[model samples]
Target: MITDDLIVKMTEFNAGDPKRIQHFIKVYEFAHVIGAKEGLDENTLRILDIASVMHDIGIRPSEEKYGRCDGKLQEREGPAYAREMLAMFSDVTETEIDRVCFLIAHHHTYENVEGLDYRILLEADFLVNAMEDELKKDAIITFRDKVFRTKTGLHLINTMFGLCSI
Candidate 1:
C-alpha cells in the first residue's frame, strides 16, 4: 500500500517538474475510479494506485539518457525505480511489489492485460493521454472500436471525458 508519506516523497522527488507528479496523480485518481467500478479487491486497487503513480517515473531518466521519452523506455527503466521508491512501504508484500512494478513497467505498452485492474490502469492512463492529445474527433469511435474494451474503464472514459463511440 502507498502511504501519504510515500506519495509526498515521490511528488517531491522531481521538484524540477511538477507536471510529472500531477500527471501521476491524475492517473492514480482515474485508476481508482475505474478500479472501483470494476470491483477490484482492496489489495489490487492499492497496487493499481501505486503502479499508476510510478508509471511515469521513467520519463525523466529516459529524457536525460536517450533524449527520447516513450513507453519502451518507461518499461525499461520503471521497475527497478519503483522497487527502490516503494521500499518505504512495509505493508507491501513481495508479490504486491512485483505486480505493481510489472504494471508500471508495462503501463504504456498495453499488449497483455491479465485482469481488470491492469486494464483499468491502462484506460486511466489513456484518459489522461487523450486529454493531452487534442482528441481526434474520431477518438471516441476509435476508442470504442479499438481501445475502451473493459466496461468500467469505458464508462469512466465516456462519462468523465465524453462518449467514445463503438
Candidate 2:
C-alpha cells in the first residue's frame, strides 16, 4: 500500500509535468523488472522502487530556485522531500526510509555504489534517460561499460540498444 501511495504521491507531486511523471514511472518499472531478474530480495526491491520514484524529486525545487535542475542539485535537495513523503506512511520503517533517502540522494552519483538496489536504480534511470535524450550508440555503449554492473541491467541495455548478439 505504501508503494501504491508513493506512486500516487509522485504523480501528484509532478502534476501537470507529464514528462517528469512519465520519466519516474518508467524508471520505477524498469527498476522493478531488473531487480526481479537480478533476484533481489523483497526489502531491496521495495527500496529500489521508492528510490526510483523519488530520485528526481529535487528537480522541481531546483528549477524553481536556481532556474535549472542539475544532478548535484537533485541529489542535494531530494532526500528532504523523500523523507517528508516517506514519513506520511506508517508502515515504512525508519531504517528503510533512511536507506531509501540515501539511495535517492546518491542515485545520480554513480560512484562507490555499494548495493544491488542502488545499481539497479542507476541502470533503470540511465535506460530511460538514454532513450529520452536520444543518446548515440557510442554513448550508450560507454555508459554500459562504465556504469552497468548487474547482469540483468547489462542485458536490458544490450537488448534495448541492440548491442546484443541475436
Candidate 3:
C-alpha cells in the first residue's frame, strides 16, 4: 500500500511530464519483474519497488538548475529529493529509506555493484533505457555482457534484442 501511495505521489510529482512518468513506471515494472524472478525477499522487493519509482526524481531539479539531467547530475541530486518524498510515509522505515536513497544515488554506476537490489535496479533501468535510447545492437550486447547478472535480466535483454541463442 505504501508503494502504491508512493507511485501516486511520484506520478503527481512528475505531472505533465508523461515521458518521465512513463519512464519511471516502466523501470518500476522491470524492477518488480526482475526482483520477483530473482527470488528477492518481500522487504528487498519493496525496496526495489520504491527505488525504481523514485530513481529519476532528480531529473526535474537537474534540468532546472543546469538545463540538463545527465546520469551524474541525477546521482548527485536524486537522494535528497528521494529522502524528502519518502519522509511523507510514516510506514517506511529509516533503513528502507537509506537503502532506497543509496539505490537512487548509484543506479547509474555499474562498477562494483554490491547488493542484489542494486544489481536488479541497474538491469531494470537499463532494460527500459536501452529501448528508450534506441541503443544499437552492439551497444546492447556490450551492456548485456558487462552489466547483466540475473538470469531473468539476461534472458529479457537477449530476447528483447533478438540476441538469444536458438
The superposed Cα distance between candidate 3 and the true structure at residue 136, in angstroms, equals: 0.7
For each candidate, the alpha-carbon lDDT, in order, equals 0.77, 0.89, 0.92
Q: Pick the candidate with the highest lDDT.
A: 3
Q: Estimate candidate 2's alpha-carbon lDDT, on a 0 to 1 scale.
A: 0.89
RMSD of 2: 1.4
* lDDT agreement of model 1 with the native: 0.77
Better of 1 and 3 by TM-score: 3
lDDT of 3 by residue, 107-134 (tens): 8899999999999999999999999999
State each candidate's clash count.
2, 0, 0
User: How much is 132 displaced in model 2, in angstroms?
Assistant: 0.2
Model 3, runs deviating above 4 Å: none
How well does each candidate superpose onto the true structure, as a TM-score?
0.90, 0.96, 0.97
Flag clash pairs in model 3.
Answer: none
lDDT of 3 at 13: 88
Model 1 Cα lDDT, one tens digit per residue, 27-122: 888888888777889888888878877778788778888999878997898788889877877778899899988887777765666877678777
